[model samples]
Target: MLKTILHYINVNRWRLIKISKNNFLIYCSVFVGLMGGLAAVALKYLVHFMEDLSRNIGAHVPFHFMYIFLPALGILLTILYQHLVNRDQIQKGIGTIIFNIKRNKANMKFNNVYSHLITSSLTVGFGGSSGLEAPIVSTGAAIGSVTGRFFKLTTHQKSLLIAAGASAGIAAVFNSPIAGVLFSLEILLGEISIPTFIPLLIASATGVVVAKILYSRQLFHLATEGWHLQALPFYLLLGLLSGWTAIYISNVAHKLEKGIFKKQNRYVRAVLGGLILGVIILIFPPLLGEGYHYLQEVLNGNINVLQEESLFSTWLQHPLIMAGFIAALVFMKVIAAGITLGSGGNGGTFAPTMFTGAFLGLFVAYAVNLTGWVHLNTSNFIAVGMAGALSGVLHAPLTAIFLIAEITGGYILFIPLMIVSAISYIIARLSNSHNMYWHDLIHEKNVRPDKDYEMLTAIEIRKVVNRKYTAVKRNRPIKELYKLMAETSTNIFAVLDDEKHLQGVVLLDELRKRIVDGTLSATATIEDLMIEPPAVIEYNQSAEDVMDLFDTLDVWQLPVVYHGRFVGFVSKSNMLTEYRKVLIGQHHQPDPFGH
Candidate 1:
């Protein structure tokens, strides 16, 4: 029934709306945004519901240690679900989405639209240490990609809608429309213009509206007396600290994730990772789940919240102990998050980054205040620190700046936010050229940043190979080659051994020249007439490498060999034609909605 309705709408869209392609795209963006916002709302409500349920159960139970087991149980359940139902096929993280957009023409599976919604809710709601933002973005991008496919849109249109969904997801999650648009542009789209910006703006605004109407609670509330010029140097120091901290978090989290998953058995990995994560949470209770409640407490100057359920509760009475506890939370949060995700639990690092940043900021302020060296506003540093850490970790300064400002309503501290975020970003970039997401993609997935290279990578070598070229045994008479050339339209012929291995190539031009110069011998074999090819392309070679060889060798055609056996000939003209088709498909915007 849903399919029939969608088909009807698709068939009559032009007649019903009579709008231009751009305007029609705007309308699609609205729907995508609405769906993205709804996804965010659903995820939030589910996670909160689970948290409340867990809290209620904990209140009634006599075993306080049971809370530590909750994370392990959640991760185990997530792993079970993945294996039993999802077939362990769900791909998590924002890097996967970026790779698909660049290398797969922005196509996504339909199951992704709801798979993340279910898996993330289960993982995060059960007290896993990760965040729901990455899952939400993945769900939203799938919605946009599926929607574009449903309407039979162009590749560019599909990509635009994917970005639109991601923007909406971020906007709705934080209730920050501008930050959402910037997230898409900075992280996903990489570059944008007016036409693209308008759709993203509309989509982000629509998503915010949906989130506000359905789930109206503000994400964070801040009461700041503004920044003081005297705090400039402190903010600068905090910025540098945040940068190094961001590097530490990225590296530690990445290493932990790698180490945990390196185990052979999935269940063993889960049990091991979950136990370690549970122990971390046990020592520093504030590291539980998203830790936003603790972040809020820090923001409100209630540093005491960190000790509520911690093993160090009694020891935190001393100033130095409390500072140490806060510092420990800052570092341990990333470890917990890495364990949660690597153990087969599904979630993102966005919340963990912010959570760590808030605590890091509080630690800096608390330590400085303890010395009585100029009273620094703890709340101001916390807010700026959140932006600084976010900027450094994600390498998205604009997104980090606006998202913090919008969520906290701390525009008064915009200067500090800018200062810290810029410094942190510079430091992080100096340490690692690519952000965490891009770094993983480049090293793990072998994805390249060059557009042409990626496009060529997507093209299959077999698709452009001229299999119609005639092949002759090396012992065949030269007259046989002449007879075959007259029968076939191909100008190139492959000279193969009895075992079908490529020995050499025969060119019609060379053959005609030999014939005209009276140097051709009718009794000569194909080996005598054939010339060695400048290069040979393996059948499984990448199109990028093939193109490089073509340019380097200055040849129009190259023979393809598979397992040392002759396959077919690939031509420069054919490769260029295929490349042009892909370029046109990605760049050309046809009028799907006729005027």
Candidate 2:
């Protein structure tokens, strides 16, 4: 009984709790949302905590010395975080999430998640060129999932809580509750179902409120106090280009991350990452740190934007040089993103994405102004283009649209924001990029997308698992059951009627339970204790590739069927070993992965 109780608790924890179909879950969602908001607030504070320490230290260091110290700090801190704090922090941040869903039975390791959060915060705080929002989103969702586990949640309940957590995180960071909710649905949860949508909304609202209460200031700084809207069509062109730029960034981030991950030793990989950061910082100090200062300069338009403006710092502006530098910096940021992930220097992809988009916008504005549109407002074009590209990359157009309006405080960049965001999403999709974070991470695991990612924009269990199946007679005793399971040593086994068709599943845990309980005598049949019609994976399917199903199906293993017969089974352990084998390469050869 003690064992049974313990197993029940383990199985049920970190799940969504269902009080009822309607009333109870909704209440739980409210609680989850509030906590999510708090988590976001905490994440922001944590990031600043690191930044404050860096600022104190950096104040003493010479300006040029920052080029050396910044990257060195990135190196030391990264090694410490990976080797000492979270060994499992590897697989990249987004990849870690996806990998856990695939191989770890959808069981998220809370220790590892928060470890990444703090470490990532430190990376950016200490002048690492990365983003704050990505880590926060990942950590917030992880915290929500971990907290939900404590409540004995159901799978649906857990997903709801997780979505709420993500929404809160985004809302808190951007101070845009609507965008937070949209980010949760579009990026993390990948759906806007009633079950997920309502809870996420509450969470985002709570998060935004908390951020507002704490900061009482705007999140993004957009300068458009006295801009003319007569050149709206020109702004549309800017948006179109910016959107295309977002797609380009996404592709670059993915490809580079994959290439960098191939490095054999973690230390060597990290050292290389440090070296790259060093080079970029040396060339352009504005490109150093988390890039907030660089963004501020762009917003303030204090420095020359055209690469050749006035003095180096405050002199006249140089348009040609400014354009070249912006373009170069755009490429540099993508490489930085890849390096951050490769070195395990914990940070989000969103912050870098936003910074790159802003630069891209500025580039377009500069070129347009060069065309003799001097009467047009360069700052206004910059604001709209930035917002639109941000929206497009994030796949949250509505949120992106409204967010700019709010961040700019009643100033309207809506028309240009829509144009850029929509087109950017299209271009990114056209280039076959997934969420940069998720895609880069997935690619790290070397899992080829069987279908175009667009086909998987959202996945259904039916697509991943098949109902049709073949099985053995359940009337057979344990001796026969062992034989069948031996042939297919997966977590789940099919128990059929005399007709050799589906009846129930002999899950490994259930099988172990029966053995320990001694409930079934040697003569007893499989029917005495089997789950009927276990979730099945159809052959030739896209692997739906989500962590949610592991809990919802309540099995660590699943059988795969193609036309009418059982082809194979996929288990959590099986997939993990597969990844492990790939990582091991030519050195080790586990039977499952031995070439």
Model 1, residue 473: distance off in Å is: 6.5
Q: Go through the candidates in order and give each one's C-alpha lDDT.
A: 0.87, 0.62
lDDT of 1 by residue, 1-595 (tens): 9999877677757533666677878999999999999999998998888777667666665544655777777788788888898887787888988988887788998888888888887778777899989999998899999988887677888989999999999999999999999998888878868988998898899999999999999989999989888889989999999999999989987876665757458878877778778777777777788888888888998888777876667889899989988888888889889989888889999999998888888888999999997999999999999999999999999999999999999999899999999999999999998889899889988886677876798689989988776888878778887678769888889888789888899999898899999998768888888889999999999999999999998889999999998889999999999999988878665555563
lDDT at 427, model 1: 99
**Cα RMSD to native, each candidate?**
3.4, 13.4
Candidate 1's TM-score reads: 0.89
Error of 2 at 512 (Å): 44
Clashing pairs in 1: none
Q: Write the per-residue lDDT of candidate 2 for residues 1-595, one digit (tens) a residue.
A: 9998787665444232423335545665566566656666666677778777776776788756656566657656867776876664443455555444333323565774466566777777666777767667666667667765665454445656666777777777777777777766665556667656777777777777777777665665766755456776766676667667777776666665554646457777676776777666666665565676667667777545323311254322456766677777766776776676556566766777767776776777667677785656656665676576676676667766766666555356566667767776776666656656556546565443332332232333343343433355666666776775567544566775454445567766777787888876888776776775546666555433533355587657676655666555566554444444433431221222121
Name the top TM-score candidate: 1
Question: Once superposed on the true structure, which residue ranges of model 2 sit more than 4 Å away at CA?
Answer: 1-21, 59-61, 89-92, 95-106, 223-229, 259-264, 304-316, 437-595
